[model samples]
Target chain A: MTLTPTPDAAASVLAWHDVSVSIGRTAILDRLTLAVPAGGLLTLVGPSGCGKTTLLSIAAGLLKPGAGRVETRARRIALMFQDSRLLPWRRARDNAAFGLRCQGMPRRQRLDAAQRLLESLGLAPEDGDKFPHQLSGGMRQRVALARALAIEPDLLLLDEPFNALDSVLRRDLQDLVRQTVTARGVAAVFVTHDLTEAIRVCDRLVVMAGPPGRVAFSTGFAQPADARDDAAVLAGLQALWREPAVAEALGATPGRRRVTA
Target chain B: MTMATTAWIGRVTAAFLWRGWAVLVSLCLLAALWQVGHEVYGGLVLPSPMDTLRALGALVAEGVALPAALETARDALMGFGLAAVAGVLIGAAAGLSVTVGRLLEPLVRFFLGVPAIAWVVLALIWFAGSGLAAVFTVVVTTLPVVIIGAMQGARTLDGEVLDMARAFRAPLGVRIVDIYVPHILSYVFPALATAMGLSWKLAVMAEVLGGTAGIGEGLSLARVNIDTADAMAWILLALIMLLSLEGLVMDPLRRRLEPWRATRGQAARERRS
Candidate 1:
């Protein structure tokens, strides 16, 4: 039977009900239930072993939960990874057009769009022509970000993509992503180790922590996302950190290899 | 020309000279050993190096050598090309499916374990004095090695890279062509070099055993007439063909096709350790 989603499905961008996952004997996420509204910016912040990435993976359909279901109304979704993961053989412009290319867009048109996207991302024409190995780490990351946004997804999944960048690039990426996704009214689920970045970017913050990771708590700022620069938002962010799970999540030195749920 | 290109040429020549010198020394050592063997065994049992060189020159002069050498070279080329195409296609299929790979592993091992002589016996019976028998032997023996190589190449593919391609919604055709083909190429090129040399040797063996009109047939005819130098001449012709094919054809092709592997010397070094 075919089940077609109508426009009314926009009530939520994504939802997980009793979702559980395990790798070997170690359970990653156990009976986790959560939902994010359409056009929402939700960030998952948690301790290293907590299943923040696992949850993100499940949401992206990269991994399936051992038990329970995941539902999403997002017509188009894109995931931007930590590493640029560009095809080494391809140039930066070609890499940025990768998603469009996958969708079978004509090469010339996609390349033109990719060129514009790269220019907007502050990459020069020459830089766009360069290969991934030739580009700087920050530049490669931006190309990755551009690749995701170039698809114009209704939902964007980010997994600590700006972790390796300097504070400036990180801030710049945060602002760019927020502006792009928010302006498009695209819902984005971001998983990060940086509590402050999470606090600033997300409309809602969810904390996950434990041996069998579950959503420990969730909260929102009384102020709007635009007023994030204001001191009141910082105080609101500080107040949330006082929560035991939020503090624990912030203190975690996440497993360099993988996060255990 | 630009100074950078001059510097690049200088570096290439320096590398060439270094390697060429070692090759020269190795050839000298081989020649010295040949001379020692002649001294111990006499000219009848082990011909003098000069006598062998003279016989080789005479054979080239006689004009039987060139046509025979050409025939053997053709057989090896055909066999190696066939093995490459079949191996990659079959190996890719095996790599894509675990059950198929598991089933293929034992078959590949068994074929590899069996000597080329046994296959020649079977081929001789099946094809009966045809060039097909010689080519078949070369293809059968060389095919398994390349298949194993290609399968290993495909199997070791980075899962994360595969994940990235999948998440980006890359079509099945795109994934295989863009991701699998390039990754497998790093393994296949090195295997092709080995297969080329092996196919030449096997094809010659099959020719000798089956009485084909090639280098091996010349060697057999020389053996019957007790012409040791003629046999040695045929051996030299075969060696030249093998080395020329590898150095002139395969190496240039590898350099042209696989720039990624050439550029990633540091990563390869790290892997070696």
Candidate 2:
């Protein structure tokens, strides 16, 4: 479902207009204008070092843009890293509840909330009691997702959250994220280098190229949800690669066939 | 006990036995060396390990060493407590502030380079033979180490984790207490262990130089009387004290704080026990 936010700037869950960022005398992001409406997933996909992460950080309000403005109509925001980033000392339930714990929620209340969230995300009670080290990679990612969702965030920023996961786990978590976005109406921007993954989980896909990263192409996920199988996505990707900037960003010629992991 | 509990206990016992072999072997080697030294140097200089233990027993029997041990223990504890508090606070401040860290780095180096004896001498003059002088010496020698530990901890905090906390809008107090403090302790514990060992040695050294009680002062008295056996006994007692402090206190504290790093399966058992 596409929710085009009202023209009023205040209505958008997140909006970044003409944002530029530089680090240590090196420009990292050019003028970048992007917005994520309430309950939409906008994925930014590009080659490595294309400043996708920098842009996501700007959207997440972690890094200030050197040029232009970022705005959000969110009271709560959550960011998930590529790594689970679960506190090692805490068990899964506690790790999930950490954000709430930081917000000064009562222990019993937050733990109960987190446990329920974990259950909803397919974690068993025993799994929730185990420490992060004891959990499998997929389980850890699930717990991290539970942690982010526990805040009931209005805007969520995920930095290649699925990149480290195996294929089965990746698809499962991608579906979980899609379901979460729809169920909670959380605005999200997922940054990744994997085009197939970007197309799979996102409602819209953005291609960026960079010395200082800027969007080169933007398009909605065209296939119907059921037809978005691997073959369909890969077939549509050939036409996308024909655009000069897209070809360059993808490091592929128009005639060349590619399948990115 | 349940089967699982019994199996866990057995695993723990087996684990201890595994580590015990290395300890037993090391002790035997050291004992062999010590016995050889006693035979070579005779009783005047190098007493047998058994003779040193006998001398230690005699000192306790005469009521000469127990009070001294207590005094030294008190000094070490007080000095260590003072060092830990000051070191963590100052180190954290320096770690958090580049200017503060830069300004203090030179002084830390200067203090670190100075010999412990020099500090003991200065402390005696400053405090005029009080227990404070003894403690001051221990603090002077021990504080720099823990400070370095804390500074490194502060500098090396994972930026990603902090960013996650920030995005969650964690309160300032929560960030400081939970995220910052726990992260800082990863570096602080090892430094703290080093500081603990230094405190006891420095306390005794300071007491020997300036005070009228404690193991150091007693050591001086033994030296004056040319009672090498008693001096050796006091040395043995100090070693025992240091070993016991690490075994009974520091190791347990570390395990409690960082159970995750312990044996993965046994961690729960250790925590429960």
Candidate 3:
């Protein structure tokens, strides 16, 4: 979860050292070096095909980097993909406890933990026994979240996990993720294209450039911890939007101001 | 007593009986045509429906058909069970490994293309009028279909669900039983059901061609006697046995394994009020 060190010092849980990945002779991630501080929420933001997903894939051990090493102190890791990916055959609670059940946990224990998580996420007790098709889209995503959390993972990776939800539901889920991950103290790396979601949920932001993805920019929140409004966060985001390198990399007009404060 | 309620009941009953009536009427028309053709021909070239039914009833009364029918059922079940096991294993392997799929593709296609007569002749040579002829016919006719279904199921599985399983480091057992099995089963069951029917038909052909004792043997004997009505009667009996066997074995098992298909029967009460 949260690792707070003395002022000006930070701890690291997951790190990548000069990682590069190639697919069919084409480089996808090139010299992508990143260090995620223990218990900090680091958000990766970039345009499509910019290797944000690739970077997360390598970190989760789903893909091996061709040229570099990834170090992870967290033995338990959970990844949430963009599609929610609920198994249509399994009931919601069984889906939620998938990892644990896969880990050979006792059925009763897994069921109990799954039930608790479903309850925490506002799913009815009976709803846990219903199949995925019976649940709405928002409910499916919530079940996916519950599945990941049931493992009690020390590290969580999310790839645009809330993209399918409407704006209000998205905001509500963002708040839920914020509160849940903080309470659990899990280190999370969230990938998103939404600038506002990045500002709201991420403690730090890393942007990547394309073709052979490289870290293009890194920034901290401009607003103090007390201010979480759209206006204050939008000010910092607007500044990043104006960066000539960011604009050039993103293929937008190099120095245009779209938001005024 | 409300007229509207009575009319509503009448309409519902009519809707249900319409399809049943259509099926019954078609069967009656077919029998009439067969009877007229036999009368016009004035020979055993085609048997009249009454003649065939009388012959079938006499065969059953004399207990001449029970043993053959029982033997045929046994062979069908054995062949079908073997095919299901082999099909699922090969199908899963093909689905999981591209290399396996590539290597087996030609073999699957070849087996699928192999004529039923060719297989029957080969099986006759190998098993020589034993139960294996029937079993081999069933396997040869059905395995490829199940394998194809399994491969398709595996290919089309959602990538995200797979990634989730991998992220958790799911073991082989969990991966198959949970993630892969359910996904593939929806494909496998229908294929297996259809295959079971094919297995019975092919088994009978194998028995007939291979000179094995069973319903097919009885049909062959009727042919030898030049008893056209008896042959037709035996064929009808075989058809009835096949349908009843599928209803008794395959249908119940499928309904149990795939309860969602019977949603109206069990889950109707659970619908949101």
Of candidates 2 and 1, the better by lDDT: 2
User: Which candidate comes out best when scored by TM-score?
Assistant: 2
Model 3, residue B67: distance off in Å is: 0.3
- Point out where model 1 deviates above 4 Å: A1-12, A15-33, A37-40, A63-73, A88-92, A115-140, A162-186, A210-213, A221-237, A248-261, B1-57, B121-128, B224-229, B262-273
Q: After superposition, how far is residue A162 of candidate 3 from its true place, in Å?
A: 2.2
lDDT of 2 at B193: 95
Q: Which pairs clash (backbone N, Cα, C closer than 3 Å) in model 1?
A: A28-A261
Worst 10 residues of 2 chain B by lDDT: B264-273
Clash totals, every prediction: 1, 0, 2
Q: State which candidate has the highest DockQ.
A: 2
DockQ of each: 0.30, 0.49, 0.39
Model 1 error, position A66 (Å): 6.0
Candidate maximizing lDDT: 2
lDDT of 1 by residue, B1-273 (tens): 999999999999998899789989998999999999999998888898899999989988989889999899888889999999999888877877899999999999999999889999999999995669988998999999899889988888888878878788899988877788888887877888899889999889988999988998999999999999888888988998888777788878986776544257645654575
> In model 3 chain A, which range of ten residues has the least summed lDDT?
A1-10
Give one digit per residue, the lDDT tens place, for model 3 in A228-255.
6766566666776766666666667534
B36-100 per-residue lDDT for model 2 (tens digits) = 99999998898898888899999999998889999999999999999999999999888989999
TM-score of chain B of each: 0.90, 0.90, 0.80
Using Cα atoms with residue i matched to residue i, what is each candidate's TM-score against the true structure? 0.77, 0.86, 0.82
Model 2: CA > 4 A from native: A1-12, A22-31, A119-139, A165-169, A182-185, A243-245, A248-251, A254-261, B1-33, B262-273
Clashing pairs in 3: A1-A185, A1-A186
